[model samples]
Target: MLRIAVPFTTLLIFSNCGMPPAECEPNSRRCEGDLLIGCDDTGHEAVTDCTALGATCVPQLTRCIVATPMLQPDAGQTIDAGEATDAGAEDAGAPLEDAGLPDAGPAVIDAGTPDAGLVCTGAFPTNTTAPAMPPYAGTAYIDADAMQATDPSSFVDLTYAGRGVRTMFDRRTNSYNQVNALLFDARFGISKHVEIQVNPEFTQAVAEQHARFYAHAVGQLPAFLFRDLDTMWIHDGNDLFGGANRNILIHVQQGRYLAMYGWLEEVLLHEATHTSLDSYHLNMPRWQQAATADRVAISDYARDNPMREDVSETVPVWFFSRFRAQRLDASMLTTIENTVPNRLRYLDCLGFDDAILP
Candidate 1:
C-alpha cells in the first residue's frame, strides 16, 4: 500500500494561501504559481476564493472582480476593487454633507415693487363778488287803493252771516252788522279811540239779533272773567251775552229793539270799567291781596269769588254814583265802605275815584 501522508499544518497553509484578495492597490492582484487569485466584488475587504465565488481577476483594474458590470470609469483613470469610482462620486465643488440629498434650508421667495399715478397742480378758486339784493320788497309794493276799496268790516259781517238766529236789527246778508254798529256807537260814546284801543274786533254771533247791543256791552268785560263766564255758561238762560276770552254771544228770547238798547247802554259803563282796569294788572297776585284786605264782598257774585269778582263788581257801583249820577238800589258803595273799608282804599289807590270823576 503506497499511501502518501500530508501534514495538517501544511494543508492549512495551502488552503489559506490559495484564497484571493478582495481589496488591492491600483493595478494590483494576487497570483499563485500558474493561476490568478482574486476576490468576489462584495464591497468588503476579505480574502475570498475567486473560484468559490465564481469571480475572476482583472489586471487592468488590479482587483479581484466579479462578472457583474460597474459604471464606466473616466478616460485615463483606474479604480480599486471595493472602492467607489468617479462615476458615483459627488461634484468637484459640492458640499460632501449634502451629497445625493435635497437642500435642507428655507427657499428664497421674490416680491415685486409698487407704482403711483397722477398729482394735482392748480389752486382752488373762490367767489370775490357780493350777493344780489332780494327781488320783492315787503309792503312797499302793496297797493293802498286796492286795500281801501275792500271794506274789512263787510268781510267780517259776511263771515258770521247766517251762522245763528237772525235778530230784528240784523240785515239779510250780515248777521253781526247791527251788533257792530252798536259797538261803534258805544266806542264813540266813551272816547274817540276807545274802540280802536280796547276792543278793535268786537263783531260776534248770538242766538238773536235784538241781543246785539247787550252783546257789545258784555264784550267790554275783562278777558279772563269773560272766559270764566263762557266756560261756566253764566248767562245761558238770561238775555245777556255769554263771554269769551276774545268775544261775546247774547241770548235773546224777546224781539224788542229800542228797549233792549236802553238796558245795554245802562250797563255799558259798568262793564267798560272792568275792561279798562283789566288792561292793567287785574289778574296779578297783588290784586288778590288787595281784595283779601277788603274783608267783605259787595254783591252775591263778589261774595262767592271775592278774589276774582270783587274788583269788577265794586268798581262799577263806585263809577255809577261818582260819574254817571245813576242811583243803584243796592247802595253797594256805602256797603263796601262800611263792611270792607279796604275795598274803597284799594280803589282809591288805583286812582279810580279821580279817574272817573275828573
Candidate 2:
C-alpha cells in the first residue's frame, strides 16, 4: 500500500468543509453607516444599505433601525413627538434615559368653537320704502282741505314713534316725483338716526301756501337751475311760522336736482344739521351776533340771514367741495372760502370739520 499520511488538524477541517454557517436569532441585525447588516431567515448574514431605501439607521435600537421624518409647523414652532413611557426597573427591554435629553411634558391643544356674532359677512339689507307718517289735520294757517286734496302717492310718509313727517311733491308739476331718489340718496348718505330724525317734508303746494315759496316758480325759470329750490321752512303743529313746535319743510321739485346742482344729499345733510342744531337753540341772538362778527356770507341766500343760513349753506360746501374733494368750479370754491372763512372756522369749532369722507 502506498503511504498517504495526513495531520489531525487537516483531517478535522476537511470533515467540516461540507457543513452550513452558524445561525442567529430572529430579527438579529447591526448598523454599518447607512447600511443594515442582519441575519436572514436562512441564518445567512445579509447586507442591506438603508440609504438605498430612503432611510437611515438609528443607533438607539442596536439592530438595523430606520429613522422616520418629522413634520415641522410654522416658523419658531416645535412639534412634540410624545413622551416615552417608562417600562420600570423590572422590564429587561426598557431603553435607558439619556442624561443629555431634557424632560418633556404633554402638549396642550385648544379646540374651542368661536362665537357666531364675531363673524361679519358684510351683508346689509336694502331699504325699499320710507317710514309711514302719523295722522295730522291741517292747522288754522294750513288749509286742511287743500292739504288733504294733495295726491297721496306724491307724499312719502316717515314716522318713528312720537315723531312723524310727510314729504309731499309738487302736485302742479311732476318735479316732486323725483323726491324718492333724493331721499334714497340721503338715507344712505347720512347717519340713519339723523336722516330719520330731521323729518323734512317737500311739498310745492305747502311751500306756496306758506310765504316760503321757491326763488323762481317752477314754470317761471329755465328747466334746470333757478326752477328748483330746497327751502327749509319752520313749522309748528299748525302754522308755517309763529309755532312752538319745531318742524322743517323742504321745498323742492324734480329734474336733475342732484346732478345739475350737486346739492341733493349735501343739501339734505345741511338741512338735517340745521334741524339738529335748532334743538339746542344754538341760533340765539348772541350766537347770531358772534357768527356775524366772525364769518362773512357765502351766497345771497346765506347773506339774507347769515346767522340762520350760514351753517346750512357752508355745510354742503364744506362736505362736498372741501371734505369730499368732489370736483367743483374753482371759482365757486375760492369765492366760498374767501367770503365765509368765519363759517368754516365755526364748523371747525363745532367738530363738523372732522367729517369722514365716504
Tell me the number of clashing residue pairs for each predicted model. 2, 1
Q: Per-prediction TM-score, please?
A: 0.32, 0.30
* lDDT to native, each model: 0.28, 0.29
Question: What lDDT, from 0 to 1, does candidate 2 have?
Answer: 0.29
* Model 1 lDDT tens row, 53-156: 33444444333344432221110011111321223322222212211110122211111111121111122112122112111111111111111111111111
Q: Report the C-alpha lDDT of model 2 over 1-358, residue by residue, as the tens digit.
A: 1110110010111112356644655435566786555553345444445554444655553322223221111000011113323322122111222111111222111122222222112221221221121011110101111111111111122222232343433323312232321121111112221121222353433423322122111111111111122332322121111101122243222111211112223333433444444323234443354345444444434445454544444554544333433243344444444444444433323323321222
Model 2 off-target regions past 4 Å? 1-262, 279-290, 353-358
Q: What is the lDDT of candidate 1?
A: 0.28
In candidate 2 the C-alpha lDDT for residue 49 amounts to 55
